[model samples]
Target: MATADGEAPRPEERQIEPLHLPTPEEIRGQDIWNNCAVRSVASGVMGGGLGFFMGMFLGALDNPIMQEEMTTKQQLIFQAKQMGRRSISSAKAFGIMGLIFSAAECVVEKTRAKHDTTNTVVAGCVTGGAISAKGGPKAACVGCAGFAAFSVAIEKFLDRHS
Candidate 1:
């Protein structure tokens, strides 16, 4: 409608319709796959960084007596090399683990039944155990239990809030 000044009313002056967003269930397959890939990469980077720092801290703590015997410059150089080696190894392990775990979860969510807490827990346990199998049966079992517990806690938190 035109105002007294003979100019049309601004668009904001008109009524606006609300937008209907797609629900999670309604998301397309390609979009879901893309999301999963992106999430996996992000998880890998975060896990790698965490592992690197942890390795550095633990490495430093492991050899205090030896560190004290060395000259300051020598100790610093040795520790740097040690930390670098440990951090790189840890970063590789964590990055691979995160990538596998996230990808597995995404696959289970997309291919199996509808996404739910149960599916998430199962996926986490499976991936965790599989990844930890390199250590030993005991480690695998522990990893499975840990991941399951973590997933359950996260699910519960989300449920409570949402």
Candidate 2:
């Protein structure tokens, strides 16, 4: 159809569908912080459990030697246990850092999934690398990486869907 001035009619006149983009009012109404916190905590629990299992496995490797030596062997076993505890502690640190980053991002973005995903993953990697350098690289790499990934994944999944 043509207008009275002979120009083609505007397309908007023929359209009635509403766009779905939320306005500032809607954005402000969403509670992103609470959701992220919940997600972060859930992930932390899972990560912590996995870390505990891994620590147990590492400690188990010293079992035969530990039982065989009642004197020097016992000391070695004690040292091994101490090392395992340290590794678990590092994993816990990484997990906590991931949770903090995810929660803060959620509070800032209010359901913006991308922000939290990026922050958590990057933070995890950095924490893992740092722990590796400080402790044995292999132990830190496995524990920190595993825990960080698990917790971050939890945070990302929940934030994206919710």
Candidate 3:
């Protein structure tokens, strides 16, 4: 910028940035969330919160099995119960999923010692297989492939956008 002297300020005379002191919360956040377990738990909680909302929305749109035979009050009660049940179920599922996925990814990244799509895919496969293990071997394999592909696509999309 030009001064009254019609000249730019010299580098030596330029203003320096002021020092910043982090707040307690900021310092605590970094300190407490510096581990894999903490990150996984946080992810689980966030996923559970999102799932709860999604379940509520879906439950609101769902028609009760015997809505035609119920009074207005009864139907409302039924819907409320359904919404609550759905939300709880979804929250649990999502929380477990998030915990599993985040832990797997963290472990995989640490072991591989690399930050790349390969780690994402491996972690995704592990998560998918674990989630689908109850369905049998065939189902697990399918889930592994599907989730790995999904992870790769997501990673690629974020990479391109960022």
Candidate 4:
């Protein structure tokens, strides 16, 4: 209803019932799941696209003569197929890594009752190492180190900025 001043009553002044909100624990759990799904999908798509372009570029660089021999349309089609293959490989790697990291985070949350940077780094390292294990021991070590470093850097940057 409008007040005498021709303005509606303020929300606080009205007889409004209290709204029920989920508890912090419930919110945290939902947030974790939501973030996991979103981040995993996004990472997969982005990684795939990046890998595709990089592979195409490197392929072209490796055999400039072969690229030059093909017609424009033919080259485009060939590059597209190559890019697609590389993209699929990268997408799978990133997708698996994201799933593993998410699962590890959930486990940590359940056991420790809190999420922290160390847990995130550990999860990343494990995921990266597992993904790279197909390459060799050295590659696995490098992947683990790279992921751990990346996670720590990101966490520190976020903490500093936030």
lDDT of each: 0.79, 0.63, 0.86, 0.70
Best by lDDT: 3
Candidate numbers, best lDDT first, in rank order: 3, 1, 4, 2
If scored against the real structure, what TM-score would every candidate get?
0.65, 0.38, 0.80, 0.60
How does model 2 fare in lDDT?
Answer: 0.63
Score candidate 3 by lDDT. Answer: 0.86
In terms of lDDT, model 4 sits at 0.70
Point out where model 3 deviates above 4 Å: 1-31, 160-162
Per candidate, the number of residue pairs that clash is 0, 0, 0, 0
Q: Pick the winner on TM-score between candidates 3 and 4.
A: 3
TM-score of 3: 0.80
lDDT per residue as tens, model 2, 22-123: 888777656442576676786667667666666666665554454555777677767677667855874686466546554555554554445445655655
- Indicate whether candidate 2 or candidate 4 has the larger lDDT: 4
User: Which segments of model 4 are wrong by more than 4 Å?
Assistant: 1-19, 23-65, 135-138, 160-162
Q: What TM-score quantifies how close candidate 4 is to the native fold?
A: 0.60
TM-score of 1: 0.65
Query: Judged by lDDT relative to the true structure, which candidate is superior, 1 or 2?
Result: 1
